[model samples]
Target: MSLLTHSRQRTAPSNTPPSRGGGRRTGRRAGAARKQFTAWLFLVPTLLVFGLFAWWPIVRSLLLGFQRTNLVDPAVWVGLDNFRALLDDPLLGTAVGNTLLFVGLGILIGFPAPLVLAAVVTTVRRGAGIYRFLVYLPVVIPPVVAILLWKWFYDPGSGLFNNALGLIGLGPFSWLESPDTAMLSLVLEATWAGMGGAVLIYLAAMAGIPAELYEAAEVDGAGIRRRIRHVMLPQLRSVIGLLLLVQLIGTIQVFTEPYVFTGGGPENATLTVLLLIFRYAFQDGEYGQAAALSFLMVLALALLSAVYLRATRSWSRS
Candidate 1:
């Protein structure tokens, strides 16, 4: 060895701890920190946007629930007065009952319609793209515009539906003018406009299912119906459960179709909770009452969602 190297080795300290992989680990942690910082930096704008537009409305609604404000004057604190007003209104019960009926009908029929439609669509071999396009086309139309178009179809005189039924000797019926038929009519319109979204989602999920599974079922002598029963439905259970929850929440908030179609008319048969809130806020300018109702609706939905989630936790796992 060189005399200088030998002199350096002799003078080197013996107390330094030898690092096994400390340098590598430190580099990794620093790199991870940098990556995390970069990710947060990119996400800040989106988070801020959601906070301003989405979360802010909810926070404002809660605050306004306790105060009366019409945006033209200073807000006045009314505490529980707005809620008490809602409680005393006789129409409030009608609206709630109608809303509950809507949700129940959707659960009974609307929830399964899309699933059945998607399954049927999958079985179509010719012009599949055209079929999907047709199935999803209604959703592309603005709901207000669609409701207006449907109003013509629902006309009591010379209407398409009644005209068709007339050919079969089914007497002309007032679809929207009668209280008994009005809610059903709204439900029908809602199902037509809404089922398209669920159908598309189900189609996407169906596409992800393994073809080999179906082939195996066929090899085991499973027919089409049996295959759907044992394989398709099982694969779709989680998606179905999720859509059911969404439908229940959405049906409770049914507003636009009822508003545009009947204006909550025919003795307020189509009146729903949201329409009542709209009337309070815009028609009567009772902002406090509207906010109070909105909060109550939110609370009811939240409780329902909690119960539904608890009930379906096992369903999801399966």
Candidate 2:
């Protein structure tokens, strides 16, 4: 009987305690779950605040595009009327053209100025920090304050520019008064104000470029111009491309200069897309139209970014 019972004990399944390792693994998994839950608990407030302020506003704006309301009154659903009205308005065309002109001017003048400045600064061994500080000084100034300072500098009568030009018998020209010069004046001030950031970015990018590439180019009989063309430009391509896109987007949405400097005057010469949107909402109380216009601008910007990225993908990869 004892022999038979021993055989049965060996053959039959017996209830065994879970291995210590299995218990430890379960405890570890529970601990990890608790840690993850704690992390999410900490993130909840930030997510709530972001949703309340940022995401809610975006969603509300999208809804507002389809409704007509002065924000005090009841919102009336208007469907596509707001969008249609935008297309019908003559001012839209003018605003678009002006925006395009600003962008073009920015590309031609503003885009290259910082690059040139950075390149020149890179060659200087002494007082380089002072030059950088001076270049970046305008950026630290408040936008309105900087614009105001430039306004004084651009004063038609006894202005700094005119006074300097008078010595050479050149220009006591209307810097911001005439339509022909008003947009250009805005561009000049904008470029000066914005170039600081771009210069710093370019300087940082230049610093990352290996000195060996330049040395190799020089070894291959590449002079200054050739070295820059074959060595520097190729290396900085990605940074240059990114900054170009950012500048393009910022210039398209320009408002402050035209608003403060000219108030879209000199026969609406400097009116930009953002300024026009402002006029619609605040001036005309056309909130729906403004929202519609804003929605369209968002779409256009998104499309532009997508297209630009798609087009530049190959260049970036290569």
Candidate 3:
């Protein structure tokens, strides 16, 4: 009896491999690999589409920058000559100056206006949604429609602005006719059309701010102005910085407003880099120069974004 019992206990838990356990583990690994393969298979179409459409065009543009092409003849390698020609162009300085001025005016007049509007709209108890809708309505309007409407308002002879000013004893003034006022007019239209998006973004950001922070500031005898300065602005610094960067990039690439309104008109007073690029390609038929300018602009934007991120590391998302 004792010998049989001892033999049975020893055989019950021997070191022999459990085939079922090993099979389970192998099955688990096989399932995992199949799952991974399926996931990647699904991703293949998207990757291929992006590579073909998005990435290929970018690579082609980079390559074409150093070569000359008119879509019919074989591309001829020109190796930086196009860039040099752009540098030597007399209108380059004018375009850059106009672009810089546009950016400056946007920062000063355009940026703060939306912030103020958002702040006021936030405080209103009644009809808040109506106010928000009104502010954002301009954003939904088609660009061409809005630009045409503003064109009528900017008409020097019988424009709404001139007619209104004349009633107040002011002379009818040319808003977009003169070179001096053309850039400003473009900015005015741009800011009006653009600020709605910023306002909505800010309002969304403001919604996320902790109510307790506002209450704490108020308990400390803070007025509305004080609360905004101390509590709201600090909370929004990151959003504001992000929007500033976006606006700067967009403003530098200003094309549509100037293109539609003036065609970089009144002696190229409102010409921007993008407009110049368009002219180079379509007007002058210098595709090489256009590609070169596009490449340089991309490099500049990259450098600017890097510097901006470094400088605003505290607020930026990198």
Candidate 4:
């Protein structure tokens, strides 16, 4: 009888219904696993495509930087010889200096013009949309087309600029023909071409600023300039910093203007790093050197970006 009772007690526990919560928990775990599997199923193709197209090319380029190949002949392993050749090339210093000059000029002329234009447009009570449209029109225009249009405007003899200046007896200027004016001309066109997007960004940011801050400044006896200095400038500080960094990166890699307009001519005065890379790869058939130089430029830009981000990390948090 005692043995039978013990067996019955053990059997009684097994006979009890399974806890409802435990069943639900198992179902929920299965459901979560299915969802996770579905998510990964959808993500796999995108991952594969990105790896094949983007990551593969970057890896290939990195490998190419150390190899000498014309994409036809079998690649020869050159180790650091490509980099050594780049360092030995005198044109490298010229290209770097010219690129730096372009960046400096872009900062001086291109950076502030957008902010100023946005501020002026904000003052206009009517036709603000029309003003924005006009400002942004150039961005829609093809870059090559815009450069060609400016080429006509820069003509030394019968150009619009020369004609306009002739009325004031200012005489004709060699805008693209002379090395002195060539880079400045490129900068001007680039500024005009690119400022539209920046202007719109500034305008959007400005619209988000509370009017009460401006009103409080007015109440505190602040004039227009003072209000801008104290209120507006502080608000736009981060935006300004971001755009400045973007401009610096863009100008340093300038290629199209020098290539299309000057051909890095007038004694290679307008020659830039990117154009030099193009020359190395296409003109000189030194593909390895071109890749090495491009890799170096990438490293430089990465370093610059890292430094800027590190410097701004604290300021951005505040």
Clash pairs detected, candidate 4: none
Task: Extract clashing residue pairs from model 2.
Answer: none
Candidate 4 Cα errors over 4 Å, as ranges: 7-12
Q: Candidate 4 lDDT (Cα, whole model)?
A: 0.92
What C-alpha lDDT, on a 0 to 100 scale, does residue 165 get in candidate 4? 95
- Sort the candidates on lDDT, descending order: 2, 1, 4, 3
Q: Write the per-residue lDDT of candidate 3 for residues 1-318, one digit (tens) a residue.
A: 699998998789768776798899999999999999999999999999999999998788888889889968999999999989999998988888899999998888888989999998999999999999999999999988999999999998888989999999996878887998999988999999999999999999999999999999999999999999999999899899989999999999999999999999888899998999999999998998998888899999999999998899865553
Cα deviation of 153 in candidate 4 (Å)?
Answer: 1.1
Best by TM-score: 4
lDDT string for model 1 (101-160, tens) is 998887787988999999999999999999999999999999999999899999999789
Lowest summed lDDT across 10 adjacent residues in model 4 is found at 10-19
Model 1 spans with C-alpha error above 4 angstroms: 1-32, 219-221
- Candidate 3 residue spans exceeding 4 A from truth: 1-22, 316-318
lDDT of each: 0.93, 0.94, 0.91, 0.92
lDDT of 2: 0.94
Q: How many clashing pairs does model 2 include?
A: 0
